[model samples]
Target: MKGVVIIPTYNERENIIPRSGGRRNASQYGIIDAVHKNLPQADVLIVDDASPDGTADVVKQKMKRDPKLHLIEREGKLGLGTAYIRGFGWALEHGYDYAFEMDADFSHDPADLPRFIAEIQKGADLVIGSRYMPGGGVVDWPAKRMILSHYANIYARFGTAAPIKDMTAGFKCYRTEVFKHIRMQEIETDGYGFQIEIDYRVWRAGFRVREIPIIFRDRRMGVSKLNKRIVWQALFLVPRLGLWNLWR
Candidate 1:
């Protein structure tokens, strides 16, 4: 099946550079190489938010050498949800069968790309790489931060009543058909809440959702983009969406 991996980036030049050692980092070059290694049939789309560090330049350089690589450079640091939404639209316009959401930070392993494809082949509409599932976990995260994430997923799941184990999972694969059922224009939540919102929408649409175990590694090169506003948005949006779903 034809598939595309959508990686969102912002000021990730340090992470996208080519390193000497054979490390599975989150750089643009490393990620493209890994995706090709595991799923050569799939294409990659880098949605860069006009990274001042010249991250888009690095992707453009690679595009010269690889025809399968695609890019969309936005004006500024638009929200993460908007980046993926734009990527999904591009994938549909280009006639892709499946669209995958991934991070450029290497936090979501590119090696797992095939696993998502395998699930897609099994009639799954949405396949989530879940850290909360059995045999799934995180690496090198602080206790306080981990607790926050763990409870956040729990809270979101409870509020939304979604069957997904990882309601806030960003690493996911969605069949193009699922997108046809979802209102992409209505997805306004950004950051972690964006993940939850999509998951809930998929379930509400009656799409088959599946979660596979994956080890989520922390970013090695650049700083995290998480902020207080993102956190607060998630905290309030979950219950609001839950109530909205109920009323509808």
Candidate 2:
């Protein structure tokens, strides 16, 4: 089956392409190359939000040599959820059977792309790369941040009553069928809440959701895009979803 990995980027110019002249950690660059190397058959779709740092320009430059590398340049920073939604629409129109959500940074290893595909091939409608699972873990993250993430997942899980350990995880693979059943335009959340809502909706729609262990490392380059607004939105939205499920 055909698949495409969708990466949403904002000011990730330093991460997607190799630097011309600078003492940079090799791992901090070459994200596009790594994705192609690991999953040669799967096309890489980069949905850039017109980053001021020329992230989209770099993607366009590389697109010259690689036919499998595609890009979608948006007007501005439109948020992560919409970027994936746009990518999903494009993939479906192009006849791709599977779509993947992945980070531009090295936090979500490209090498693990195959494992997610393997699970999808084995009958999983949605495959999540889970960090809170037994064999999964986070590397080089502060203890406080790790603790917050762990507890946040617990809150989201019980609040939404979703059968997922890592509901907020962004790294995932979805069979194109899942998107067809889900009301994509009806989703209104972004960031953390967006991930949880998608997972909850898929489960509620009776799709097989599977989790696979993955080692998540903090981003090697660029600053994190997280903020208090995203966190606060998730805090409130989870219980609201719970209430909706109860009334249904």
Instruction: Report the lDDT tens digits of candidate 1 across residue range 111-215.
Output: 888999999999999999999989999998888879999999999988988888888889999998888889989999998989999899899989999999999
- Which candidate ranks first by lDDT, i.e. highest? 2
Per-candidate Cα lDDT values, in order, are 0.89, 0.92
Judge candidate 1 against the unseen true structure and give its global Cα lDDT, from 0 to 1.
0.89
Candidate 1: the clashing residue pairs are: 15-27, 16-27, 16-28
Q: Estimate each model's TM-score.
A: 0.95, 0.96
Q: Could you tell me which 10 consecutive residues in candidate 2 have the lowest summed lDDT?
A: 20-29
lDDT of 2 by residue, 59-151 (tens): 999999999999999999999989989998999999999999999988999889999999998999999999988999899988988988899
Model 1 ranges with Cα > 4 A deviation: 20-29
